[model samples]
Target: MKQKENITLSVKNVSKLYGDGCAYCAETDAVLDKNVCPECRTVHACRDVSFDLHSGEILGIVGESGSGKSTLMKMLYFDQEASRGSYHISDYDTSQSNVFGLSSQAKRQIRNEILGMVYQNPVYGLEMDFSSMSNIAEKLIAAGSRNVGEMTGTGDHFLDKVNIPLNRKFDPPINFSGGMQQRVQIAKALSNYPPVLLLDEVTTGLDLSVQADVLELIKEIQREMGISMVVVSHDLAIIRMLCDRTMVMLNGEVIEAGITDQILEDPQHAYTQQLVYSIL
Candidate 1:
């Protein structure tokens, strides 16, 4: 694996392959091993994906569904392990530190302290029964914020920072509007104050107005927080507005990566050009 110079987060030749084709599979006995591991055919969610994220830089990853966008984001969040290559955050080498393959305590520590994630589906990531404040406070608490008052204060601050109204803090995510819920989720992500942020299809299901607002909020937060960001989105307009650099993925491979303006204005790869043209 080749190293990228002075990068906060770097991924080299990473790949994720899922299972042999099967219609039905039996459940496993262990909690972690719930899915059956087959050895017949394999499907690659991500293939030889490589990229670098410098401190305070926003790198946008664009692709169609099943093109490995979400899978790649999951790997960043340590939700799934990469089958090949390595990733580094700050001085921590993911492959060497047992970062992904770690004890629950170790994994939880790294996840809470170093990384923050804003998922595509807000409802899916959030607790429907808990208030937005509770959802946000949980992550902060896990990340080492002790006092309830402090947690609540920090949660409120983040919610305000993400532009979610304070009045909605006690409301359950299910009760809030889609955009509002997404904002609350963003607040939760920032509550821990992680140096690296991963956003996956956050604005996909939003309306035009909400999308604009959400994108703006993200941009403002990135600038203020000065954290490295990896945003996975299919929306070209959002990418153009928010990203400093862009990577175009096709069929689970990165076809192009360069300055956002250069790729958007004059893409070199045929697939990149096609994707940009289709959206434009």
Candidate 2:
């Protein structure tokens, strides 16, 4: 990617393990198949994962199912806790403090004001039966927005930005098609004007045409908003299209990461080579 810009988000030695880890599992050199330790029977969903997100850039985490890419996104969004890790965002606590150590309230504030997330499933990000505008308002309200008129205006602005018709702003998302629902989710996520956005398989399961539209919307949003993004997907094609840099995860570990084009053209790790070649 272009010259390194200011670091917007940084993660260090992040891990998530299930089961009580024994000495064998604790060994840094422990051998595990598919992230499961044979000796201790513990599952390491993510082990010592690390990465950085630069301002105005999109970082993609690509891996197959059970590769722990989604688990990493969950930890960053606080949907799940990291067993061990340090998360620092430039907009939070001067970017020096580890967010994992913060109180629940502080984390909520960070989620509301500093970071926005778009889940692959709109159900997780939207209130299906609530007005689309209400969904956006909910996030604004969580960020301490009290002025109803202003919140509504912000809601309208983002809805329009995402191509959600203003006329349907009061309609429940349940009444919309899948692509439209995803659009609403995108609108709600960006309504906060967050410095960072996390997208987990945002185009998964959409029709090919619809997928292209959503992908275009995302790129346009990043270009116009200048928001840093971390996008997680299992598809190499999606990663190639959307990311400035790419990280390939396997068996709960990042085996390769670098400029998207470089990784695509010249992947170093065997697993990464397989992924790149499969897409070609």
Candidate 3:
């Protein structure tokens, strides 16, 4: 028998609601208008979203705008607190504790040492006014690196891996193009070599050529570094290129999930079928 793959990250019943939910929202018999509770107008950004990311796996979350995919990504990165959920990283405390329940300090440590995030908007992930090298150094410093030489070396290594020219490393991200800014964000996210990487629409606004290059870079990183990644993108083409398995989210709920090829070839959900066919 084949040995079971280790689960790098696990989440159970994760939810993020923007308003106080009403009893109707909790009733299985009640109808919801999209992801909103009509009775309370509570925006259920993510309702019971859960998944397991295996070692060295690239899992994709795909959905249209406002489908809660970004919200789920934010919750995974601890950028947005989950209202209810149990999140555990196998490499952290043997996955015995729900990270969401940890103290702010502990969560910060986890963010620095275990989880790395690249947001859809570069503004959320990069310090535009800071030099590209300084942005990377900031992450290293947070992860407990105290030696300037070591930090500088690490920053150079990652920036180079992402194809950012050494000569421009000292320049601020504000001086770079959108694609270059995203590359700097990627370097910063990988500076500490976190075991799990969360990417939320990282290629959203880039030109087609740039998007392809970014996606290729992500694949190279995963292959060489063995970093398990959770990639969120609405574009099915991007998912097809980067993900091994995929989950389709609609109205804040995962409507279907399975191996990426299976979903592309035989999407079961109506929304998912529409999504897959639209790209053809």
- Which pairs of residues clash in candidate 2, taking residues 3 or more apart in a chain or in different chains? none
Each candidate's lDDT (Cα)? 0.80, 0.93, 0.92
In model 1, which runs have C-alpha deviations exceeding 4 angstroms? 1-5, 20-40, 91-98
The window of 10 residues in a row where model 2 has the poorest summed lDDT is 1-10
Each model's Cα RMSD:
6.6, 1.7, 1.4
Q: TM-scores of all models?
A: 0.87, 0.97, 0.97
TM-score of 2: 0.97
**Best-matching candidate per lDDT:** 2
- Write the residue-wise lDDT of candidate 2 on 211-252 in tens digits: 999999999999999999999999999999999999999989
Candidate 3's TM-score: 0.97
How well is each residue in 71-165 modelled by candidate 3, as lDDT tens digits? 89888888889999799888787478998998989889999999999988999998899999999999999999999999999999999999999
lDDT of 3 at 126: 87
| Model 1 lDDT per residue over 1-280, tens place | 2344557877878877676433422111212111223433456677778888987899999987877888888887878888766776664545345255566677677788888888888866788779999998888888888899999899889988877789878988898888988888888888878888899999888899999899999998987889889999988778999999999887667879999999989999887888789878
Q: State in Å the error of residue 129, model 1.
A: 1.3
